[model samples]
Target chain A: GQQVMQIPQYQHVQEGEDFTTYCNSSTTLSNIQWYKQRPGGHPVFLIQLVKSGEVKKQKRLTFQFGEAKKNSSLHITATQTTDVGTYFCKGGSEKLVFGKGTKLTVNP
Target chain B: GAGVSQSPSNKVTEKGKDVELRCDPISGHTALYWYRQSLGQGLEFLIYFQGNSAPDKSGLPSDRFSAERTGGSVSTLTIQRTQQEDSAVYLCASSRWTGEKAFFGQGTRLTVV
Candidate 1:
């Protein structure tokens, strides 16, 4: 069985602070996808990384894929109250095995 | 369709009853997936349907859970002898055969008593 584990199950930060969540897989992954779920909303795809040691950025958000393809990270710089949500990393096989997710809470 | 659609936004049933959740994926998509999310928990893979090929039921927690996709257009997830543990938000998503980003529906929230 394949498994993707995430750290910092919960994170709370004040507006203008930074937040980061890490994900690790038990086995190598062909690719990894990140998603965000708003309070009481379904998960929305944010980004996907395929190449090893790849880093992609979206404004204040930065995504990184490990060189081994077994780990990934999502970092938010200068967070805002609107950034409150759970971030998930999905991998393993092609069935979308998702990690437990890291829930982010921001206070203004 | 513009996006995935699921029926019965919420469901409440007594123990030992049966319930079925429906999912309609975006047109022209060939990959459909079902997952369960308990309170404060992550996505729990239930099954995967790819085109007309055999489905992957490896993530199903028990035999009571089953799903089917008709004409590769719509899917239904059925649960028998529902238990309290079955109370969770069941989510459905669809993607192209290339396995790109998946578009999800609002999901059906089931609460079994």
Candidate 2:
């Protein structure tokens, strides 16, 4: 069985600050996907990275996969109140398994 | 556009009761999956249905849990003799295939009291 763990279980930042969360795994991952879930809401897909050392960006968010395919990160630049949510990193095999997630809270 | 819809957004049931949750996936999508999220279990895969054939039930937690897909459309997950440990949010997602990305439904929150 494979398990993914995320660093910084919780983080709070000023509205204009930058925030990043890291995801690591003990086993090699075939692919990784990022998701954001609002309070009391379901997980929404953000991005997916399959190749080693792959990097993708969406506006203010940047996702990267480690060269070994065992780690990943999500960085949000100039965060806003709307970016407050739990971010998850999931390792995909035949099925997808999620990490505990990093809860981001932005303050004004 | 219509995404995915799940029924009875919230469910509260007593121990030993059987409950069923339904999910309606996006039209023309061939892949549907079920997962459970809880503090103790993170996000665990339950089952996945591909096309009209039988589903992959390998991820189910126990024998008490079962699911069915009809007409290659809607799906229903049934939990028999539910226990308190079964309380969690059940999420449903559908994709074009096994390797593609997926779209999720709001999920059904189940609380076994």
Candidate 3:
């Protein structure tokens, strides 16, 4: 069995501040997918990192995969109130495993 | 359907009762998964179905929980003799393939009292 560990279970930041959440796995992963779940909403796909040491960016959000493919990170630059939600990382090849997730709250 | 759809968005049941949750995945998706999420908690893997293969039930907490996918499109998760601890949101997700990004349904919030 594989486990995905996520850090900073919860975070609260002032609007315009930056935030980062990290994900680590007990085993190497073929790919990692990121998801965002807004309050009262279901989880939505955010991005997917396949190549080792890959970095992808979407607007103010940046995602990076470790060179070993056992770790990943999501960073939000100048976060806004709309950024309040839980971010989860699913890692694996055949059977993807989801991390507990990091819940973020942005204060306006 | 435009997206994954779950029935009976919210359900309240008495303890010891049996409950069933339904999930209608997007057409053409080959992978379906069921997960449980307690309040302020992470997603707990429950079961997975891939095509016509036997489902992976390792994540099931007990014999009380079981799920089945029929015709490779719709799924049903049943809990027998439910307990108060079963209260949580049951989420269903589907992906086009084994390793692709998943699309999740709104989820069925179950409360066993």
Each model's TM-score?
A: 0.96, 0.88, 0.97
Chain A TM per candidate, in order of listing: 0.96, 0.96, 0.96
Model 3 CAPRI rating: high
Scored by lDDT, model 1 comes in at 0.93
**Residue pairs clashing, model 3:** none
Tens-digit lDDT track of model 2 for B89-109: 999998877646778899999
Tens-place lDDT digits, model 3, residues B1-113: 89999988999999999999999999999999999999888889899999999999999999999999999999999999999999999999999988899999999999999
Highest DockQ, which number?
A: 3
User: What is the fnat of candidate 1?
Assistant: 0.75
Instruction: Tell me the tens digit of each residue's lDDT in model 3 across A1-108.
Output: 467899989999999999999999878988899999998888999999999999999999999999999999999999999999999998886665689999999999
Supply candidate 3's per-residue lDDT for B60.
95
Q: Which stretches of candidate 2 lie over 4 Å from their true place?
A: B39-41, B52-54
Supply DockQ values for each candidate: 0.71, 0.55, 0.81
Q: After superposition, how far is residue A6 of candidate 3 from its true place, in Å?
A: 0.7
Q: Point out the worst 10-residue segment of candidate 3 chain A by lDDT.
A: A90-99
Error of 3 at B79 (Å): 0.6
Q: Specify the CAPRI tier of model 2.
A: medium
Q: Model 1: runs farther than 4 Å from truth?
A: none
- Clash tally for model 2: 0
Query: Which 10 successive residues of model 3 chain B have the least lDDT summed?
Result: B36-45
